[model samples]
Target chain A: MVPAADNQTRSENETKWQLGMLLSRPFFSIGRAVIRWINILGAATVFLFLALVKVFRSKQLSKIVQQLYYIGARSTTIIMLVSVFTGMVLGLQSYHALVKFGAQGAVGTLVALSLIRELGPVLTAIMITARAGSAITAEIGIQRISEQIDALHTMRIDPLRHIISPRVTAAIISFPILTTVFDLIGMIGGYISGVMLLGLNSGVYFHSIQANVEMKDISDGLIKAIVFAVIVATVCCYQGYFAHMRRDSHGAQAVGLATTSAVVISCVLILVSDYVVTSLLI
Target chain B: MNTPLIKFKDVTKSFGDRTVLERVNLEIYEGEVTTIIGLSGAGKSVLLKLIIGLLKPDEGTILLRGKPVSKMKKKEINAAFAQMSYMFQGNALFDSLTVYENIALPLLETTNLKKSEIDRRVMARIEQTELTDAVKKFPSELSGGMQKRAALARALITDPKIVLFDEPTTGQDPVRKNAILSMIAQYHRKFGFTAILVSHEIPDVYFISNRVLALYERTIVFQGTPEELEDFDHPFKDEVIHSLEALQKELTGLYSKRQFKVLNHAQMRRRAFGDTYCIAVFTLEDINSIIRYLGHDAVQEAIRRMGLYIDKHFGVIGGFSTRRNTNEIVTVLPYSDITEAENILKYFVKDFQGLEINDIWTGVRRRVAMAGPVEFTILAGIAQGQPIAEIDSVIDSAKSHQKEIWTATMRRRGEKI
Candidate 1:
């Protein structure tokens, strides 16, 4: 009976100690996390600055063109598909909502404004983050894990300049152009839905859209697209660049985790920054 | 003397709280293949990474060709790296890139070489590595050996003045290993580049290495030619040369019977060079009586614990233990002085008194109480400059004399005489 009581007390003491440890873990974890992020951000900023300074100094025009092809030209079909579907849904929903107030002519303005000013850029950024950003992270992470990045360093080739800069520049150039294509196709889809499907007046639909969307609206969205592009590319490259430094995981699992983290982080940041930029622009 | 091509002066490095290297000093001369060998997790890779500036040391300076690498500017370091090439152990071939493109990468990225020139150089390297057939294939398509050759080709494509190889022959067949070593040696000789390699292939590496550096206890413990490595009397060097099994008892981490064999071999081999070897025998007095009181398992546990303590204290200073007979253990201390042996014997008494015996059978399944303090007496015999055959006689006489003295001293004290 005494031993059992002693065992119970020992177990209670152990549980209390474990609970204390559990309570203390978050503080240390947060501190380590903060340090890790600061280091990552500092290294990433250095990489970006170094890449930008040396990006044009080296003559890799062919390589940049190759990257532009991979990032932009290959993505056009998917962007078109997503834009057309989003525009059709927006057109259908807005026509029904505006029809209730007996002002169905304003459906064109709503669809065009949403597609050109908000949905086009945000959706394009999200899609690119899902497609290209994840891929870049995995590719770079694998290179890091396989030591190709180290090999490049040994060869006296700055990996940031040779591997990352072209991809970044291509994404920056590609995003705005992709947003433009998405807006154009989305407006066509809106016109098709509002006029042919909803039996709205075609003349009013086209005129209202043209009159409502100013150059500033388009330019503002393009600027947002550029910002999102930079954020996504930088985040992906940073995650990949430092994936090997993670001691908790390695090999394919590390690369996979890095890719998922890159995509998720970039997408969330894109949405949040989209709201922030919209509020600031307005 | 001419300046060494690479020099490490009091270099120290640590990762977090773990110190990987401590005040390491080494010098690698030009046009020589120096192989560094050590146990796993002994900072062998850290030393190689330090040379290439992939890892920065916490303290001290590494000079490459009279220039301090750690203090160099980015451009300076890159320029220094341009003349140096490192072949990675895992053969870091770019998977997405074809063999030709991978080999052509340095020319494309660093050098402003023309397409024709780049192609010519790439083709030459491909031919040299015998990967012409797989020039268009990706790294994943090639076998491990082929990928290693491709990586080597890429490393050598820029014609670096210095090459660092990290385990160039690991996980390879003997034929491939020999081929790789010969290729490295031949290219090093032809190009007149200094080569530094970290490898576990000791006997094979001995043929190509002009010098060998052994890393032990986070420091460069031994640096000399292969002949010197073979002739060195240090227990750590023995562990590195002929597998750790030869130097340590696997279960106890104490010096095994192989240490005695090595001592005998070293004594015989160094006799012509006029070097003297010594042996000392230590017996745990009445250890058998204690075993009889306890059990066989407990006796084994006690010996293991005692061996661990002795190894931790004495192994660093060229002292290692092996079981001599059933109840006796002998420590063979080569190049040892009488004072050092006497000091060790004196320290052991105090150390043994303070030592605690851990309960080996305590767990959730069997809740056993911790064991009490273990007490023991030790009798020792020392023999110096004796032939391997005659050393046993000397130890026997010394053992009998020491036992008699211990008994008389205990009798005088009225203890357990």
Candidate 2:
């Protein structure tokens, strides 16, 4: 009341703050809902798998096993080859550095520990995500656009259980197994480079690797693999699933948007979950 | 009668509140050719998607087989998918797969059939679409018409009870469009499946579609037979009838259409040359280039061969013609208008050797006669009365301005001026 301009300014400020709250609440609510949906789907997929394992036999088991085979067995050769080269490169680099300090024997410790506890699991998770994520995303997206997903819901088939569950569980099973295989091949590579190629005694090489790394390190690698698996599979499935769910009249843009979001969300979640898993465990 | 296959009740679909289908109530029955006609974006495709479960109504329910789609379970929905197959707007054949593989996917994945039987059925479908040659070809490798046929083959692979065609004639040449439509009609006849097609193409009314549904403004504006829509006595009809009537008229008088077109072309050509007088006539009668069942490029070569000597003398240019009606076209030299006489006549050719004329379809052949100042330029001799033939007779007979001989059509005086 002291001045007309001052009163208008105060009212404008109040309106802006109120509008911000209005926008913020809905935005945060949707984001939180999406995250909760993803978690529920993840846990639900695990439960469904357990339930299916009890009831399914013979043909069903073979089908699910065949799916897992397609996901994992097909991936093993590339995973092993890449891991061996990664370890060999690490051994070579670390050997040169350690020898400068007259600690060439520590090459085993560096390669084994680094590959197992970090590169092996993370790299494997990334590769499989790229390979399988696009396939799942595109399939789910097309399904959404085509009304197959709605048809499932109408028929009392839970799309999450039938489609998402199988994919996510398959990814979860595949990644850790693939990572373990990577670790073994990576250890062999470290041995070849350190003991045979770099002239460290085979005995000292094994001893240093054993002494420096513990069960905790292997467990850390396994844990990282599990987390990365869940993140990639869940985020990708969620993105694909939600992107496909939009009932926009313009179907092409929606399908394209779904594909892009699936890849981006899977990649970001992998990175974010990587940091969280590392910080909590370390 | 049996319960309707699909029922939409007050189903309002919107994209972010911009409602496309507003409170639309419709019922689709079994084994009927329901052709939906409207302007593009009248939400015809959206309505098809809604009925097929591709989209959900924001306001109401879609009932299929007497059950609300919203309440149905997933297995039931998958079962429904078996009963219906959708041919998308672009004939969404999987470009990555061969025609055989694309058709085989749904059969192999969804049905409990042996691979051998699936192959047999897929082959049978390819043969039925007259696409036996395209079985191993990827979708992108095929021509536009062939791609649509392949998609139709895939749609039929399931032997679905209901087939949805989204714009079956959107991009095909007229001859190819008819070829696909005939195949669709054949499938409808042989299989007795419900054929609901969403299209904006003008209907071939004489063919007698069982029902025509038009989406206008935001609701089902007209629902009737093709004959009923053309009656012009209907109540509550959206006002696009005059244009529709004109299209119907053009479709019937395709002969006159081609002749008038050539006359128009001659007019434009004469204008282009400023004062250089030349008569020309052509039919938008798209021949070899488009009428592939008429024998590929062989028909075009035959037409060219008839005028090979004349083309050299006239600096003649001819290719595909602009189609107001997509039947046939003959160019007057530098054509598209109908002002010139000599240019039109000299350039006209009605009956080329080897260019077979379908009496009713290729229209009555005609010749155009135009007298030019430079040594009686006997451009083309077309037979009189028939669209292209009359113009050819005009070229042969009209030797001199004094021997104007026979002015066949009074329209030729109109054609002359």
Candidate 3:
């Protein structure tokens, strides 16, 4: 009878433990995810710092120029294509909506302000993220897996100095210029739709753009572009530079996963930081 | 004793929950080719990385010339690392860079050398590596062997005091493998740098290594000369060395000479005291002439075909074959006397002689056709022996009885001359 009683108690204890563990499992998973994200954030921050510090190293200018050609110059056509369509769509939509209020002449103010203050930087960032950001991640990931980075280390060449710094610098410089170009081209697109197609007065369109678009609006867009540049470059480079450390994959598969993650994380961060920056600036 | 150039003192390394190496202690002296051998993922590469500071040990001290690396200042650590270079297993030549640019990158990045000086150094290394014609070509454009040579040139461009080669001959054919090892040995002698190589090319690597360090079970199990390693009885020898020899046999379709001896011993142990076995040494005569007339690739093809034929004929009757050198194949027939061995050899010779040129020249036919006809002879020598102790004498006797058994010379007209 005593032995039966002990077994019953043991079963009850096991049931309680199991129930408790089941109830706490989600919390444990959440906590683990939180810790993992925090670790990644910290590592990325350190990576960015190391790369930024080496921005002025010898022969860095040449590497930076090379990256500029890849990230900024090469991205112009795609950015221009996307921006023009976006501007035209905005022009068409805003014209219809403002026409209902008998304010169709204000279309130029709306188009210029929208492109310069919001769509230009955001869309430009996203476009570059798709084009050059993915490439950088893949290149660096391949280098990491193939031990090219380790080879650099053994040669006493700091990989951050040789690889990442030039890229970060180039992106920081490129983002602003590309954003400005995106603004100009998108404004022209808006002009094409508003003045040429919709028959709004060309004079009114040009005058409204000149009068309503403030220096503050332009600067805000540039600031956003620069911030997005940092986010995109840091996240992409970090993911790829440490692709070999991924627990879920290895080798070429790890590189592919890193590239995907880099693009996804960079896009998400750009949107989140866009909101934060817009709110702070406003 | 002289101070070791690099020393790992009770070092431990781990990744998350898995410990790859624990409390590992080893010493590599200056100017010695110390090869670290182990199975895949046995921390041989981790050891090399630890020395070069590509990865640091989680615990314990790594001393360079008696100075603990972990205790050194940042600048001092950099200074120590600057004296070393690594040749990665994959060659790791920058895919975007041309051969000249790849080899020149180290000098351009690390040193403040003038452009002309860098060009001169790069050109010299390119010529030395026999990559002069490939100067403008990217790594992807170069062949595997050429890429390895480019990587070696880059590693040696700095004239580093210490060099680490991580499986330098991993994915190479037997000829290229030996060529790379010989190149490493030659450069080691010329540069007199401390070299730590991670490899599984047993016996081959042993021939070039001054000190052999065997890593097994996360720690170095043996450290001694290659001769000492042969006599040193350990699980590492049985597991890693013997298994790699087995892999070597699979890759080349022939046993190494050491593996042949091991098999001979095992066969003798299985047999009665007075049981007679036969040793036949088949030599591909006038190998230099064949090489000269038909090119190196054709010669290699012929040898490979010969090995395949030997296996096909002798392997059925429990006979094993090994390539004694570049031109000779030694077959050991267990429980067979001279008469049986001769009979088998006659059949093999006749079959081999009647083989179409297409059979032996499948891959190299175009090259062979361009080079025209070449005459080559197969010579076979046989001797019977009872005692395992007299196996060497038996082999010597077999070599002495070598006589031409078959000859073939192909003409462009599809007729044998």
* Top candidate when judged by DockQ against the true structure: 3
- Candidate 1 local Cα displacement, residue A198, angstroms: 1.9
- Model 1 residue runs over 4 Å out of place are A1-43, B71-76, B244-417
Candidate whose TM-score is highest: 3
The C-alpha stretches of model 3 lying farther than 4 A from their native spots are A1-25, B246-417
**For residues A146-236, could you state the per-residue lDDT of candidate 2 as single tens digits?**
5556544423235665566666667778889999999989888888887778788989888988899999999999999988877777666
Q: Write the per-residue lDDT of candidate 1 for residues A1-282, one digit (tens) a residue.
A: 568989999999999999999999999999999998898778878877776676686676777798889888888888999998888888899999999999899888998889889999999988888887888899999899888898887787778888888888888899999999999899888888888898999999989988888999989999999989888889998889889877768888999999999999998889899989999998
Ranking by DockQ: 3, 1, 2
Alpha carbon deviation, residue B129, candidate 1 (Å): 1.4
Whole-model lDDT per candidate: 0.76, 0.63, 0.86
lDDT of 3 by residue, B1-417 (tens): 799989889999998899999989899999999999998989888888888887879999999999998789999988888989999988988898899988988899988999999999899877666677899999999888788889989999999889999898877787567556766776787789988899877766776789998899999888889878878888888888888888888767878778788889999989887789999998889766665455444566667677777866799999998877667788999979889888888887777667633576554454352245777687889999986556779889999999988777865422356
What's the CA error at residue B243 for candidate 2, in Å? 4.6
Ranking by lDDT: 3, 1, 2
TM-score of chain A of each: 0.89, 0.75, 0.97
Per-candidate TM equals 0.71, 0.64, 0.79
| lDDT by residue (tens digit), candidate 1, B1-417 | 679889999999999999999999999998899999898889988898899878888999999888888678988877777788889998888888999998898888887889999999999888766676898999999988788888888889888888999988777654456457766776786688889999875455666789999898999988888768766788785566667443224444644444556665665666644444555665667653443333223444444455566666667777666655434566666665566666666676556545432222111012111223333455667665544455566557546545411211121111222
**Worst window of 10 by summed lDDT in candidate 2 chain A:** A51-60
What DockQ, between 0 and 1, does each candidate earn? 0.53, 0.11, 0.66
Model 3, span A48-144: residue lDDT tens: 9999999977889889999999999999999999988888888888899999999998999999999888889999999999999999999999999
